[model samples]
Target chain A: MDGDTRETIREVAIDLFSTRGFDQTSLREIAERVGLTKASLYYHYPSKQALLTAIVSPLLDGWRAVTDEAEGMAHTPDNVRHVLTTLLDVMVVNRPLASVLLRDPAGVVAAAGPLWQDMIDVATRLTNWVAGPEPTVAQRLRAIAAMEVLRAAYSSITYLREEVADAEMREVLLDSALGALRR
Target chain B: MDGDTRETIREVAIDLFSTRGFDQTSLREIAERVGLTKASLYYHYPSKQALLTAIVSPLLDGWRAVTDEAEGMAHTPDNVRHVLTTLLDVMVVNRPLASVLLRDPAGVVAAAGPLWQDMIDVATRLTNWVAGPEPTVAQRLRAIAAMEVLRAAYSSITYLREEVADAEMREVLLDSALGALRR
Candidate 1:
C-alpha cells in the first residue's frame, strides 16, 4: 500500500507538471490531486524539486548506463547503431519528463543544476565513445552532430506540439543520427 | 571615435565573457580592458546585457537574413547545400559571440529573453524552409536534426575548449548538416 501510494503520487505529479508547467504547479495542488494531505505528500517527497529530481533521475541513469555499456563495446557501425537506438528509446520513453524539462529550461535547469551538469558530462563521454579512438576534428564534430540529432526525439514533441509515435521517433531519429555519423 | 570605442568594448567583453563566463565577467572589467570608465561604457551601451546584445545582434541578424533569403528560393539540393553553407558561415564568423552564449546558456538565454525567442522563431522558419513544402514528419525531423548539427559550428568552442579553424568548422558542419538532410 505504501509503495502504491508513492507510485500514485509520482504519476500525479508528472501529469500536473506536464500540463500545468513546473513552476505554475504547486505542492498543494499535487497533494490534492494525489488524494494525500500536504503532510503525507511531504513525508513521501519533501519538496517540488525533490519530486522533479525523482522524475529526471531515471533519464539521467539511463544515459549513464548506456554510456557505460557502450564504453565496453567495440566502436563499430553495428555497435553505434545499437547504442543510438538505445539512447533514443531512453529519451522517447521519458518524453513526458523531457517535455516538462524542455517547457521551462530556465527554471528546470536551475533546479536540476548539478543533475544538468552530470548529464552534460555523461553526454561528453558518450560523444567521445561514438567518435571512436583517435578521432579527427571532423569525426569529433560528426559525433556531436549525431548526438544533437537524437534530441529531436523529444524536442519534436514541444516543437510539433503533438505526439509523434515512439516507434516513428525511434525509426526516424536512429536513421537521422546514423546519417549524421556518415555511416 | 564613438563607434570605434563601442566596437572595442564589445571585443573586450566577448573576450572576457568567453574566458571567465558571462555570469562571472563584470562590466567594470570590460571597461577597464577597453580603457573606459564605467560611465563612459554606459554612454555607449547601458549595461552588461546591452553589451552582450550588441555582440550577439549581428549573429541573430545573419540568421534572420539567411532565413529570409532561403524562404524565397525553391528548396532544391543545390539550394539546400548553398543555404547550409551560408548558415555555417554566419555561425563560424560569429563564433566568438556564440562561444560566450554557449558557455552559459542559462545566463544568456535569460538575458536574451525576447531576442532568444526571436531566434527560435527564425530558426523554426529556417527549418521549415529546409523541410520544404508538404514535408513529412520524417523530413521535418531531419530538418530539425540538420539545424542542430549546424550548432556544432559554435558549440565546439566550448565543448572542445579550443579553436577549431573556421575553414574546418564550415567544411565539417556543412557536410554533416547535408548528411542529416540526406541531401
Candidate 2:
C-alpha cells in the first residue's frame, strides 16, 4: 500500500509538473490528483525536489547503463551506431520525462548535482566520440547538430501526432542522425 | 535623444531578459541597466511587453524580408540554398536578440499579436517549402532537424568562442544545412 501510493504520487507529480512549471506546482496539487492528503504526500516524498529525484532516478540509471556499456566497446562506427540506437531507445521511452526535463531550468536540475554532472559528462563523451580528438569547428558543430536532431525528433512525436509508427520514426531518426554525422 | 534612449533601453532589456527569464525580469532592472528612471522608461515603452516588442520588431521585419524573398522563388534546391544563406546572415547579425526571443515564451511576444502571427506564418511557410506540397514524415523531420541545427550553431557562437571567423562558419553551416536537407 505504501509503495502503491508513492507510485501514484510520482505519476501525478510528473503530469502536473509538465503542464504547470515545476516551481508553480505544489505538493497540494499532486495530493489532489493522487487522492492523497498533503501529509500523506509528505510521508511518501518529503519535497517536490525529492519527488523529481525519484522520477528521474530511473532515467539516470538507464543513462548510466548505456554509458557503462559503451565504456567496454571500441570507438568504432559500429559501436557509435549501437550507442546512438540505445540512446534513441532510452529517449523514446522517456519521451514525456525528456520533454519536461528539457523545458525545466538547468539550475533546478543542477541542484541534484551528481545527476547533472553525469549528463554533461555523457554529452561530452558522445560528442567526443563523434568528433574524435582535435576536432575543427565544423566537426564539433556537426556532432552537436546530429545529436540535437535526434532528441528533437523523439520529442516531436508527442506533439506531431503523426500516423507514422514508432519503429519507422526510429529508423528515420537514426538514419538522419548518421547522415548528419557523416555529412 | 529619444531614439537613442529607446535603442539603449531595447538593448539593455534584451540582455537582462536573456540572463533572467521574461517573468523574472522587472521594468526597474531595465531602467537601472539603461540608467533611466522608471518614469522615463515607461514614457518610451508602456511596459516590459512593449520593450520586448520594440526589440523584436526589427527582427520580425528582417525575418519577413527573408521569407518574402523566399516566397517569390521556386522551392528548388538552389532556391533553398539562397534562402538559408540569407537567413543565416540575419540570424548571426541579430544573434543576441534571436537567442532571447527563441528562449522566451511565445505568449510574451504574442500580446501585440501581429508579430506573433507573422512568426507562425513564416515558420509554416519555411517548413512547407522544406517539406514540399505533401511531405513524408522523414522529410518533415529532416527539414526540422536542419533548421534547428542552424539555429543551435548560430546561438553557439557566443559560447564556443572559437577562433573561426564568421564567414567560414557561415559556409560550414550552409553546407551542413544543405546536407541535412538532402539527407
Candidate 3:
C-alpha cells in the first residue's frame, strides 16, 4: 500500500510536469489529483522537487542500464547498432519524460544534479564507444552528431507522433546513426 | 529613427525572453530597458506577442532563405553541405533568438503562424534534399536522422559554447552535419 501510493504520486507528477512546465506545477494540485491529502503526500515526498526527483529516478536507472549493456558489448558495427537501437527504444518508450528532459534540461539539472551528471557520463561513454580507441577530432564530432540526431528525434514528440511510425522511426534512426559511424 | 526603435525593441525583447523566459518579461520592462515610455513601446509593438513576432521575423526569413537556396541547388552531396552550412551560419549568428525558438517553439508558433510554417517548410525541403527523387525508405530515414543531428548540435548553446570555439562552432557543426549525410 505504501509503495502503491508512492508510485501513484510519481506517475501523476510525471504527467503534470511533462504537459505543464515544471515551474508551473504545484504540490497541492499534485496531491489533489493523486486523491491523497497534503499530509499524506508530504509523507511520500517532502516537497514538489522531491516528488520530481522520485519521478525522474526510473528514467535515469533505465539510461544507466542501457549504457551498461552497451559497455559490455563488443564495439563492432553490429554491437554499435544494438546499443544505438536500445537507446532509441528506451527514448521512444519513455517519450513524455524524455521530452521533458530534452526541452528543459537546465531545470532538471538544477533540481537533480546527480542524475544529470549520470546522464552526461552515459553520453560520454557512448561517445567513447562510437569513437573507439585512437579517435580523430572528426570521429569525436561524429559521435556528438550521432547523439544529437537520436536525441532530437526522440525529444520532438510532436514531430515523431505525426510523421513516423514508432518502430520504423527507431530502426531508421538507429541504422542511419550506425551508417555515419561506418564511414 | 522609427525603424531604429522597432529594431531596438525587438533586440531587447529577445534578450529578456531568452534569459528570463517569455512569461516573466513585460512590454513595460522592455520599453524601460530601451529608454522608451510604455506608450512609445506600444506605438511600435502593441503587445508582448507582437514584440515576440518581431524578434522571430528574421529567423523565419533565414529559414526561408536556406530552403529557397537549397531548392535551387542540385541534390548532390556537395550541394547538401553547402545548403546546410549556410543554414548553420544563420542559426549560430542569431543564437539567442534561435534558442528561444527551440525552447518555447509552441509559444512562438501560436503568436506567429508563418514563423512555424517556415520552419516546417525548411525541414521538409531539407529532408527532400537529402533523400532526393526516388528515395528509398532508408534514404528518407537518413535525411531525418541527419536533420535531427544538426538541429540538436546547433540548438545546444551549452554544448556548442563549450565544445568548439565561438567563431568556429558553426563551421565544425556544419562539417559534422554534412558528414552525417554522406553515404
Candidate 4:
C-alpha cells in the first residue's frame, strides 16, 4: 500500500480497462500484472470496483477543480476563454483519465450514484461558464452546444493522435469552445 | 427492396445497434423487428456490414455537401456561420443516422474501406474549408478547432438533450462552432 505500488496498480488497471473494457477486466489479472498477491492487492483496494474508482479519482478531481474555478469567474469572453483553456489543458494532460470518464459503463453510472452526480456537477459548471452570469436564453443554448462540441473533440484520441501536437490541439480546441460562448 | 422498406430496415438496425451493440444483434433480430423475412432483408442488404454502410452513406454525403459549400464561400464570420448552420440543420434532422455514423465500430473504419475513404474525403474537405482559399497557420488551427467542436456537439445527444429542442439545438450548436472562426 505504498504510494509506488498504488500508482502501479492504477496505471495497469487503466491499460487493461481501456483495452479489454471495464467489465471484461478482472482484479486478479490486474494484480498478477502488477506482481502482487491477491491478499496484498486486496490490502490496498478491497474490490475491483474500488480499484476502478481509484483509477478515475484524479479525473474527477481535475474536472471538479475546473468547474469550481469557472463558477467564481466574471462572465466575460475573456473569463470564458480562461475557463475553457484550463478545462482543455486538464483534458489533454489527463487524456487517458478523460477517456475512462467518457467510456464509463452505463451500468456503473446507473449503480454509482455519486459518479453520476459528479458528472452532472462538472457539466453544470461547464454550461454556466459558457452562459456567463445573467445569460440570455440564447446564451444558455449556446453553452450547451459548446459543451457538447468540446466533449466530442476531446473524447476521440484516435482523431487527435493523427492531426496535430497535443499542446497545439488543446489551444485550438479551447479557442473554438470559448469562441462559441462569446456573443 | 422498395425505398420505404429499405429505409425502415435501416432505422430498425440503428436502434438495435445503439442499444444492443453491433455484435450482439443479429440479422434475424433485425428482420424479425422489421417484419421482413431474412430473404427479403438480403435483397436490400447483402450483409450486416452492408446495412451499416447504407445507414452511414447519408452522413458522409452531408459532410461532403457542407464542406463543398464552405469551400466555395468567402471565409468571413458570416459565411462560416451560414455553412455551419446549414450543416447542423441537416445533422439534427438526421440525428439517428448521424448517431450511427459516429458510433461505428473502430475496427470497421479500417476494414470497411469505402466507408473509411468517404470519411477521409469529408475530413479533407473540412480541413480545406478551414484552411480557406489560402489559410494562415492560425486560420488552419481555427478551422480544425471549429470542425472538432461542431462534430462533438452534434454527436452528443445525451448531455444537452434537455436544454434545447432538436431543431433549435442544431442552430445553437452551429452558432457556437462557427464562433471559433469569427475574429
Q: Best lDDT goes to which candidate?
A: 1
| TM-score top scorer | 2
**Candidate closer to the true structure by lDDT (higher is better), 1 or 3:** 1
Q: lDDT scores for all predictions?
A: 0.80, 0.69, 0.69, 0.67
Compare candidates 1 and 2 on DockQ and give the better one. 2
Off by over 4 Å in 1: A1-56, A95-118, B1-5, B12-42, B47-52, B100-113
Candidate 1: residue A156 lDDT (0-100): 75
**Range of the 10 consecutive residues with the lowest summed lDDT in candidate 1 chain B:** B101-110
Q: Candidate 1 overall Cα lDDT vs. reference?
A: 0.80
User: Fnat for model 2?
Assistant: 0.23
Candidate order, DockQ descending: 2, 1, 3, 4
Backbone collision tally, model 4: 1
Q: How many residue pairs clash (N, CA or C atoms closer than 3 angstroms) in each of the candidate models, in the order given?
A: 0, 0, 0, 1
**Per-residue error (Å), model 4, residue B92:** 2.0
Across B13-127, the per-residue lDDT of candidate 2 in tens digits comes to 8886565545456788888878878889988888777777787777778888888888888888888888889988888788777766544433244344577677766766676
Model 1 clash count equals: 0
Task: Report how far residue B66 has shifted in candidate 4, in Å.
Answer: 3.1
- Chain B TM-score list for all models: 0.85, 0.88, 0.82, 0.80
Per-residue lDDT tens digits for candidate 2, residues A75-152, read 678987888799888878887665556544332343355776666667666665666467777887777767766776
Candidate 1 lDDT, tens digit per residue, A1-183? 456888888888788666555655678898898777788987878777888899889988999999999999999999999999999888888878766764454456556779888977998899999999998888998998898888777657546655677787789878888888883
